[model samples]
Target chain A: MNNAVLLQSVRFIVLVLLQVTLLNTINLSQYINPYLYILFIITFPISDKDNRLLFIFLSFLLGLSVDLFSDSGGAHAAASVLIGYLRKPYMRFSFGVSYQQQGQKIAQSPFSQRLIYISLMILTHHLTLFFIESFSFANMMYVIQKTLLSSILTLVLILFSISMFKKKQ
Target chain B: MRQIIIFIVRNKNFLLFLLLFCFSLGITIHSHIFHRSTFINSANFISGGVYGTVTNISDYFSLKTYNNRLIDENIRLREELLKNGISEIDSTVTSSTDSTTNYVLHRAEVYKNSYKAPKNYLLINKGSHQGIKEDMGVITSGGIIGIVENTSANYAVVQSVLNTNSQINASLKNTNHFGTLSWNEKKDYRKVQLTDIPKQANIKIGDTIITGGMSSIFPKGILVGTVEKFTFNQSGNAYIIDVKLNNDMTNVGYVYIIENKDKNEIEQLLETTENE
Candidate 1:
């Protein structure tokens, strides 16, 4: 019904499609699969009046869609929800009270603040996804390496996409 | 009632988060325990269909490589045919002998393959309708591939040798000593491990490994790998040999599913003997 809602909806569809069709198939190496779909949750607009329940619900659906196409069972969904649940706190910690009081979207924040927000979000998501998928600590170093490499790739892709698409606001 | 309502409203978001998180974790646990839960079944169907289409498009790009492999295999087969003579091969085919004729081979293409995971699986384009069943041995002309684990109407999932739980009977080509073949869960796609060979068995680097024929699944002397390294285990009674597989599990495209004709009868007889 509104411009923001329409744009966000389009973004969700495009990100999921890109992830399953192209990003999931790109096996640069065993440990460096780039998960660009987390871009949706990382950039999801948050404000005091934003409905936390709706945010997480949408995150779950977005993840399930990717998992359905990638055949990862529910690992993506769980990780997405975990990040979604933590998004509010992480945003507050990264942006501080002034940005919240001004009701600024994360994309409009300072470069350093945005970097911290995206990196933390991507790292948390990748760690949760990899660990739950492995479900073991036997390969702790392997898991950590994968988490780090994939997070870096995801962060780079998210930043590039934001730079290309997000209009200065 | 008033206090309860206030508390619920105050913590509703956290409660909802917990609920959804548990629901997803439940799905994960269910799929892991059952291995073929409804969630996985539907997910597999959707993902398999999409991957099949994607592969169809991408397969053209690799046609040259695939064609080269096929030509090589064809030349080797023709050489064998010429050396052994047509009649000898024909007689073995017509008669049920232990040599090659006892098993019928069906050709299938690898539709989806994963070598990076600890529990890797391969999806092939043949299934029950094509006479494929569980425990049938799958191989490429290069060497062993995996075993058929589950089948749908027109698709089958293979538990690859790269998987943690995979164990196949393998033996050294030059000797009678045999061992169990498995994976070390290492990141390399080209190597697997062979364990349980007796320490007394003389083993050398580059010794060929092949199927032992002791199991109903794979026949005797099918090429598997070569001994890359060997060492005595801490027990000092057995050797652990690292094998470099001939079939590159990462790049496998064409495979043959070996169906032993007398597998059912043999299994039944063995069961009866055990009962006695």
Candidate 2:
């Protein structure tokens, strides 16, 4: 019913579609899976209407769509849901929202906290992703290599998309 | 119902989050396997569409490169068509096969190509839809590029000869000296050291390296590169010649996948002897 919630869901759907159809197919190599769709969840405002439940739900949908096209549905789910779950503690910790003021969602998240949250989530998601995809300790160096490369690329895209769409307040 | 709604509202955020999170996890675990891989597959198809759309936007500049490749390929094929009268079976190449070869030519455009990596590969625009198959040798006007690594209906990947791990038999045109062409990972020059070249054989820096055609992967005399530096390795049984590739693997745009007329037979023969 909320304007922001509806728009965010639409954005999430659009990101999932873009990620699966266009972005996923851009296999720069056997590795380097770019995760641009995380932008949807990252940009979702922390409001009463759009709470943690919506975050996880939308994240799962986006991730599942990507993983299917990506040939690893569980992979994106694990990462997306992890991002979703951690978003709460992450928001609480970095945003400096007091425990008593928990229900007060920040309409315009500060750039510093947003950067930190996005970086940690992106790092976390990519680490789990490439590790599970490579699935071998034997490929220790390569797995790490893939993780770093994909994360950097995905991070750049996430930052670009969020800044482009988010209204400055 | 009123009490339950009140309780749920009190913890709506947490409960809703958990439920959605769990639901997504359930779908994910199931979708990972082939049993429910259709979802992921559909997702891939959707992603493929999106990729196609985005490429369309950025394809303007790349179009120049793509057009240049097409022109080059067109000229080569047309010239052959004129001299061979479109029926002489490409006399530029001579085969030892007992029967007339039935070579089929397929057009493929390189989509994603990389040579910076140790094991380099290229993804082409053509796939099973364009009659591409696994192990089909891909080439360009320059020379032998690589072999098909994977294939879908719309796209396929080629294992580039520039890859460090790539091994193909080649010989010096002048002295009949032979060795393997391997990537020198340290340099962008793509100097392939022709190993096992008879120590006594004459090899000059300007000498040419061509496919020996000892194997079916590539035809004979397709230029691999030219000797940049020639010397005996630690083991003097061969001359380790540094070959400078003529076709820059990094700039590959348009490629012609050479389908050996007798590839199946060649494969069969090799497979039979592999056990021995």
Candidate 3:
């Protein structure tokens, strides 16, 4: 009915399609697979009303769709929901409590603040995802290596894409 | 009741997060069990159909490579026929042997193949409707792929050899020194590890590895890979081998699902033996 709802819905469909069809198929290297779909969660618009609950539910669906395509069970859902629940607090932490009063536009934020926000969220998402998917303490070091390498790639890609889109706007 | 309702409304988001988090964790744990099938996988109707459509377009790009592989395979088969001294005019097929007679092959196209994850799986187009079932072995003309974990009506999910949970019976091609072939998180898709090989067997780099057929799924002597390197596992009683797989797992397309006709009979016999 409205531009925001339409944009978010279009984003949801496009990101899921890109993830399953294009990005998931890119085996650049085993350690460097970029999870660009989480960009949808990261850049979801902040509003005046507290819709944290709705955001978390949407992210759960997002992650569940990915797991369905990838056959990864629910690891993505668990990680996405965890990050979704924490995103508000993360926003407050990175951009200060006055962010809500300032209309919390992530694109308008300082480069350092945006970097901290995206990197922290991506690292947490990757750590939880790899640990849950591996589900083994015996392979802790290996899992850590995979998490770090994949997070770096995801970070670079997300940041580069965000800046590219920002310039276009 | 008024006070409880107010409290519930206050913390509803946290409560919902907890509920969904636990539900997802339960599914993850259930999926880790090797035998039991879980609700979430790509072998279902929606995911399978999506992958099938995607691959249909992408398959054209790789048509040249697949054609080359088919040509190579045809040459190999012709050579083998010549070696057996069989003439094309003699319409009789090669005489059936115990090893080859019981195994039936069904061809399927892989709709999706994943080797990046530690617990990877493959989705194929054939399923129960095509006589495919769980525990059947999947292979390309070049080498092994995986075992069918479960099948939907029109699709099947295969637990790939690249997965950490995969363990299949494998041995050296020249000898019967059996070992358990598996993958670890440390290795890439091209390499898998073979463990429990006895210390006495003469081994070398590039030694051919093949399926042991000790299990009911794959027949004996199906090509697996070659020994990339090896070392004695801890305690020094046996060898831990690194096998370089023959298949480039990331590029799999068409595959053959091997159905061992005697799998049920063999499993039942083994079950009775264990019970006794």
Best of the two (1, 3) by lDDT: 3
- On residues B20-61, what C-alpha lDDT tens digit does candidate 3 reach at each position? 889889889989874447889888888887898899999999
Look at candidate 1 and give me any clashing residue pairs: none
Candidate 1 displacement at residue A8 in angstroms: 4.3
After superposing candidate 3 on the true structure, give the runs of residues whose Cα lies further than 4 Å from its correct spot. A167-169, B1-4, B87-97
What docking class should model 2 receive?
acceptable
Our model 2 lands, by Cα RMSD against the true structure, at: 7.6
Candidate 1 residue-wise lDDT, B89-162, digit = tens: 65446654446667899999777777766666788888788888989999998989989877877878888898
Which window of ten consecutive residues has the lowest lDDT sum in model 1 chain B?
B36-45
TM-score between model 1 and native: 0.89
> What TM-score does chain A of each model score against the native chain A?
0.94, 0.80, 0.94
Query: For model 2, what is the alpha-carbon lDDT of residue B221?
Result: 75
Candidate 2 residue B91 C-alpha distance from true site, Å = 8.5
lDDT of 3: 0.89
